[model samples]
Each structure stands twice: as structure tokens, then as C-alpha cells.
Target: MKAVALYGTIGSLVLTALAAVPAGGLTRPDTAGAGTPAPAPPRIAFGRCAPVERLPSSVECGRLTVPLDYAHPRDRQITLTVSRARATGGPKVRQGALVFNPGGPGASSMHFPMYGKTERWRKTARAYDFVGYAPRGVGRSAPLSCQDPAAYAKIPSASPREPSAAFKRQKYAEAKAYAEGCARKAGPALRHFTSANNARDLDMLRAALGEKKLTYMGASYGTYFGAVYATLFPGHVRRMVFDSVVNPDPRQIWYRNNLDQNVAFERRWRDWARWVAKHHKVYRLGTTPQQVLRAYDTVRARLGHRPLAGKVGSAQLQAAFLKTGYNDAYWPVRAAALSAYVKGNPKPLLRQTLPQPGGEAADENSNAVYTAVECNDGPWPRDLRVWDRDNTRVARVAPFETWDNAWLNLPCAFWPRHAPRGASQDPARFATDVTDAALPQAGAAHRPVDVRTAPGALPPVLLLAAERDGATPYPGAVELRRRLAGSSLVTERGAGTHGVSFGTNTCANQYVERYLLTGRTPARDAYCAARAEPKPVLPAK
Candidate 1:
């Protein structure tokens, strides 16, 4: 249920709602069917949400009216919000527009233009207009919301078996209430927010920009978006860079995916505990890993019955624990905080704020759009018994996170709507008859842009799995590369993190940058070595 990016506020509602399925359950519609070829790119028609005079000269913002359904281009229209920062160098050097997406099925790309200002990006800044936008049902675009923050905050956390059946019943009731609340508040739009629609919108954006092709960069969930776009609009693509790619296998749902994360974190937690034990002088939890782990579990168990001063409860603890897997930089801080809480001072832990609430309106908007899209993309088992069996199996191996993840996604058990049709089981077949003129040349160089069609397209995409990644597992990356036809494997070595870009190794950064800027992929699916922190020098006395 943890949102994936800075736009976490909007995404939290949808992710939490959909996280109930097993891994790969949210497969999007295959792009293989007959549909009219996409229309030619549209000319730019700039319009302002606010007066243009008040806008900053460096930013160009506007809205474009697109079809609510591409199949009926002349029908109902919705306005999509967009923003751009023009290239800093002279016009002669401009390379065209480069669009960016920071992963979140729901994240806003509206601020992506600013990334060009960074030292790494500035090198390429002179050549392209950096573009950003809010996806449908997200920020400043007909936004969604739920009315109650307290109601959402009160959702119970996962816990161990309790003495009474009454307690378990209360927990179940709480989950049901949250699901019902969302259904009552979110209406029709809740059924329309699929990834396919978003992809269609991206193509529409390409048209409005007057570009013959799209050049893009996407991360995490954004990678999935980029992949689908390539499948649907292969000809319109000039170049694409996807980092920390999500596997496209259809069986793994968001909830099932968390089970993989839980197992990964359990290993990481033990590793952290061992380190804490070795440095007992700094953190006096214990002098051995087992002792320190016991101490940590003791704190979790104690909070289950009585929350720490009514603020830091088991749910909050689990949320915080899950967040630790996102980055190694957070490990020591989290350990210190946990040690402090176990020793009876809970203020630091309690003070950690939850993601900013989108308020009732935004929550309903997000929830509605999320369900509309996710449920429509694939079919989830409607039988509670199936979930019961799957979750029980998962719980046997990953006791810490399975049930909590299950309850987080309980809304799907009673999802108010269903997808238009069930997803196809077979991989979609590409039409060989589609003409070359229909496809744009891969770049100025005439290289075929369809990576999937190349011998290397199925080659191992450099998988940067973090040792302690909680949302997506390091092993998942390994498995993904293994499933890929010619993939070679690489580890972050010892890095414990989520998205590998901006947060970890310089070596990893260099590898990714080289691939993006020069298309020089790692020679054999290499792993960037882990970066170790430098030891502090004590004054020589």
C-alpha cells in the first residue's frame, strides 16, 4: 500500500486498493488486435489554466482535449494538463522534447522538466524540451479524493494470532468498512483508469507536440508504462530508457508481490540486526543477531495489544519497517529509532508522518480512477476461498507480511465493478502485415527501435535488485532476468534500496547514464558493484 513516488499521496489510494491480488494479476490488455492506426501527430495549441501573463517565462503550461475513448475520437473529450521547460541552449542545438515519468501508476510527471537542471541531466539539456504532465484522474487533471483521513488512518495493521475471536472479527469488520467506503464514494470514473488509456493519452500527447516520434525515460512502474507504449506505438518511438523495470508476467498481483518483498526484508532485517549486535556499544539491543531480533519482535508484540501512547501502533510499525527496505541510508536510522522505541521512548517513531492525505475529494478521485483502470486491465479471482488458500500458503513462509498485505487489498474482494473482458492468457500475437510506412524509423540513424524485435531485446535488461528492497525483491529481479531469453544477471552487490537511480551507487548511475545517453548497454548484463561508505578519520592524538 506504500505509494511508489513523491506523488505517493495520489497513488496510495489506488495501490492499497489493488494490492490484494497475487503477483502479476494486473495484466493490461494486449495491443495485438486490429484498431485503426493512430492518427497523425496534432499541432500544438497552447491554452492556459490560469492567465499566461502570470506564468513564469521558463515554464510553458497548457491543457489538451483528448478523446475519453480513442475508439471514438469524435466523442466525449477530457482535458489533460501538461507543462514543459524549454532547453536552455540556443534553438539551433535543440534536440526536440524529452518526456519523463517518475514511476507511480498515479504519479504526476508535471515536475519532470526540472530534472533537466541537475548536473547529470544538464549535459543533455541543450538538446530537448523537458516535458511533464499529470496522468488522468491525478493532480490538477479532474482530481479524485476520499472524505475521511481519520477513517483511512484507522485501518488496522497486520498482527499475530490473538487470544479472542472477537478481536479478529473486529479487524475483519474494519477492512470491510474501508472497502465499502471507497465503493460508495467513487463512482463511474473509478472504472475507467486503465494503463492502456494512459498509454493512449501519451500517444495523444506526442501528436499534440508535433513530433514524429517520442523520446522518453521511465522508472519503476514508469518502466511498465514505457514497455506498453512501445508495444502499442512502436513506430512513434524514437528512444526509450527504462530503469528498475517491473516484470510483465500477469500472475503476480500487487499483494502477491508484497509477499516476495516481505521475504527479502526478513533477510535484510536479520543482516541489520547482526550489524547492530556487532556494534553493541552504539546500539545496546544485544551482542548477537538472534538476541537483537528477539528484542525487535518483542517491541512489535508489545505494541499489538497496546499501541505506544496511542500513536505508534503495530500498523504504523509495519509501515515504517517496510519503508526501511527502500534505501540502505535509512537502515541505521531505522535501527536507531527501533532501538529507542524498544527502550520505551516512542516519540521519534510516532512523529513519523504518514503520506500527506489527499482529503476526501482527492481520495475518492484516486480510488475511483485506480479501480476503474486496474480492474478493467485484468480479472482477479472473485472467490474469497481462493485468496484464503493463497494467502495461507504465503503466510507459512512469510508470516510477517502476508496477512497484512492481504487485508490491505481486501477491497478487491468486493470490488464494485469488473473489467470489460477477461485478460487473454496467451501472449498477444503481433501483426506481420503492418507496413513499414506505418512505422516511423527508429531514430535519425534508421536503426530499428523495436527492442523486443531485436536479438538483444530479449537479452537481460540490467537488473538492479536491492538487497533489502521491501516493495520489490532482489530475487524478483534475478528471476525476471532468468525468465528473459538471453539475460545475464547483476546485483547491486550489497546495496539495500528500491529504485536504483538518484539514490545509490555512482557506478550504477554511470552504467545507466551510459546506456541512456549512448545506447551502450552493459556487455553481458553486468551488476554495478556496491558502494561502501568511507570510514570517518579520528583526530590523531
Candidate 2:
């Protein structure tokens, strides 16, 4: 699952109030020629939702059975769990459901509707029923899982470090074994756990929700999901707000994206390091970015031989610091942990990261789903030599996360290529016609998405990007906005956070409120300054 979060800075829309469209209507032209939707599926059979700890008591949950393969509607079925919070109707008729996805490709979003309960969503919650659902093979939706939750811990993550032939063999073997484990343990879902499949399932969900057009807010990887859905079912999308946009470059998919991630994370780390160095007197870790990174690197080196709490290894230590890459909020906390560990007390970093023994390890199912989607979404270079060369090259410059994220997705190289019926869909080639008899062939490598068939005119789509987001960087929004006509690009000028919308920046959230509730996007592409930097955190007592 991709790491995600809130808040970033810079985008200005003329708040010179244009007459807000009737809350129910959008100014976008009709989608008449786009295509027609299938008849509404049997109204979702709503059942009593057992209360969950965080969800509102009145939020209802239901399950919808969708074909595992849209190619064969009668084939095996999988169910997705959906949750909803009914809008508090005001003077106007409700504007249908506002679907949400918190991203991950693995994060359970059953509680997404809870955003409506928070003040962030206060201005617009009543305009639409907020709906959230666990996408296929994710939390509570016939989850995809592996046999070993500790799989990642057993092997060292791919290293940006130059590896010997022996290390290469070990990585290859581990990656192969990990992929096989998913096939054996995750069962039959691997073949179908793809964005294309999920996009189809979402259409079915849209049908079940009784909506001819869909309104959605998808973050991080969820934005990719919505993109796939829009590409697959363009006519059905009414309004979409994509936040912390995932790179939709058909050429990058998972591999090159991770390469970009290496560059981004190291850049973000430097940002944190500089910030730490700025507050050098208070934390006393270092007085320059180089010095702070050296101190941090020293701690990681020590963890390489001795894992903290026997669970937080060098890789785990780096993972713990990733929050700082997402936003500055965790700077003090991670800085404190880093400061404490370097000063002979390792407990704070341990408590902050691996709270319990083995807690830092990824959950079995989560890792499994992360693998399922990334691997299945597109083809990976299967040649170990290719991987070695590319990774060795990336290490020379963008070294920090190059190998770690590489091995994170390496399982795909060895994933079972032969499906029970045939090959899986060719993500590059749009599934204009899916068929059980002749599903797209997934060769060892595939081509980039054909832009000739890219998504077309529709509603004015909105995209949110931060100036320096590590996970889903800003360039992605540029590429996507070009492809999605009438889409407006909004930048948080200095916001470093990944998931920027509906969070800390009043300006960004205000834009979201305007678009989602008033059907008014920024008058033009806009930029908002990031909120003032958060003050340093006081170390825990």
C-alpha cells in the first residue's frame, strides 16, 4: 500500500464569488455522446451494519456481489463491503452520493464516510451522501493475503547499495518465493486483483448505488483507480476530485515510479534534514543537512546489525522516518526518536515505530494486496539483470529508497503468468472488450498506454498537487491534466504533504468545498501557498 496523508501549500483561485450553480447542477456540458450506463443493478440490499469503533452509529454497511471477471458475468463472484453516511438534508435536495477512496490500493476505506463527521467536511457534507467502500481484495472485501505477515522482515529489502552476485541471487530467490507465496496463500484472487478489474467493479457499484453519473474524491493510488474508471467508463463520471495524484505515466506504472520515488524521498529527506538543522539548538542532532543525515545514517548503520526491539532493522528504521517525507508534522516526533536513539536510548524510536514486537512489519494481507495490484497492473522486467542494472544506476544518485521500494514490488517479476483460463489484461491496451475466452496477454513486458484512446471531455475534473510530495509527486498532475480535458490543476505552492485536500490548508480545502458542493472549480488553474510550517514538537516525557 502507498503511504498517504494530508496538507500542503499554494494555489489561488479567485474567490470573487461566481454565482454558485444550483448545488445539484454542474456547468459542464452533457455527456450525451459519451455513452449510456447499464441499467441500475438491483438496489443494493442494505443490511444492518454492526457498529465499528470509529464509524458513526448510524452509518450503514452493505455488501455488493460483482463478477470477479467482467468478461464472464456468470463466473466466480467476489463481494465488496460498502459503507454510507446519509447526508443531513438541508433546504435543497441531496446531490447523490460522494464516493471516497483514501488510497493505498490496500488501505481499508470503510470508514471514509467519517470525514463527513469532521469539520473539514462540515461545509459540504449535507449536500451529498458520503459513501465509502473497500475496493476488491482490500479490507473486509474478501481480502487478499499472504501466509506470512513477517515475510518482509525475513528478507532484507532491495538495497540501493551495490550488491554482490550472492546478494543478487538471494534477492531473486526471495522475490520468487514471495510471489509464489501469494499464489498459494492469497488463492485465486491474484489473477483478478488489478485496477482494470477494480474499475469494472466500481461501475457495478455505481449501478447499484442507483446513480447514472458518479461523483468521487480519490486520493493517492485511489486517484489512479478513478482514472482507470474514467478511462473505462467515461460517460458515467459526473465530478471527480483527485488528490495527491499518482503518476499515470503508462511507461512508469510501478517500476519507474519507484525510481522517481527514490529521488523524491531523498529530496524530501533533505527538506526534513534542513528543517532539523534549522532547529539545531533545540534538538541538537546536527547543524546542517549533511550533518543531520550523517547522524540519521549512523543510526541506520547500527540498526543494520542489531534491530531495535528485534523488529526494527535498518529498513524498518527508514520506514519509520517516511512520515517526515509526507509532511512536517511528524518532524519533531521522528527527530526526537532519531535524537534519542543516537544518544543511547533506543526506546523512543522503538515505541514510535514498532510499538509492539514485530509491529513494524507490514500486515500480511496488506503487503499481498500491494503486490497484487502493482504487479498485475502492468508487466515488470523479468530479467534479473535488467533490475540489477537499473537499480545500481538509481543508487548512484537517488539512493535512499531505490532498493527498498524496488523489492517492495519485485514479487511481480515472478508472479504466476499463466492464469487458469489465459493471460491477464494488458493494462497498456485499454480493455475495450474484455472476454473470458481471450483476456489480454501479459507478456514479460508491455507497451505504454495508448494516448490515442485517452479519456475525453466530461465534467471539469479537479486535480490537487503539492510542490514537493514524495509519494505522488506534482508532475503526474501535469500529465493527467493534459489528458483529461477541462480538468483544472491546483497546486499547493509549498505544501510538502501528499494528500493535501480537505486537510490543514484552509485554501486547498476551500477549493475542494467549492468544487464538490457548488460545482465550481477554481476560475482557472490555481495555486495556494502552503500553510506556515508547523512548530517543532516537544519530546515525549
Query: Which lDDT values do the candidates have, in the order given?
Result: 0.55, 0.69
Model 2: weakest 10-residue lDDT segment is 8-17
TM-score winner among the candidates?
2
Q: How many collisions per candidate?
A: 31, 14
Reference-based TM-score of each model: 0.76, 0.85
lDDT of 1 by residue, 1-541 (tens): 4325532220111221111111111122222232333344346555443552234456678786666555445545677788888888867777678787766666677767676778766756777888888777776666544337455555334365222356545655665565456545655445455565676677778778876677777666666556556554555666665555555443343434544655665666666667677767666778998898788778778777777766566776777766655555555666677667666666666655233444544444454444434444443444445556666766666666666666655555445432332222211121222121232111101111121323343323444555555555655555445444344344576666666654447777776555545545666556666666322221111
lDDT of 2 by residue, 475-511 (tens): 8888888777778888999768777887788889888
490 Cα displacement, candidate 2 (Å): 0.5
Report the lDDT of model 2 for residue 165. Answer: 82
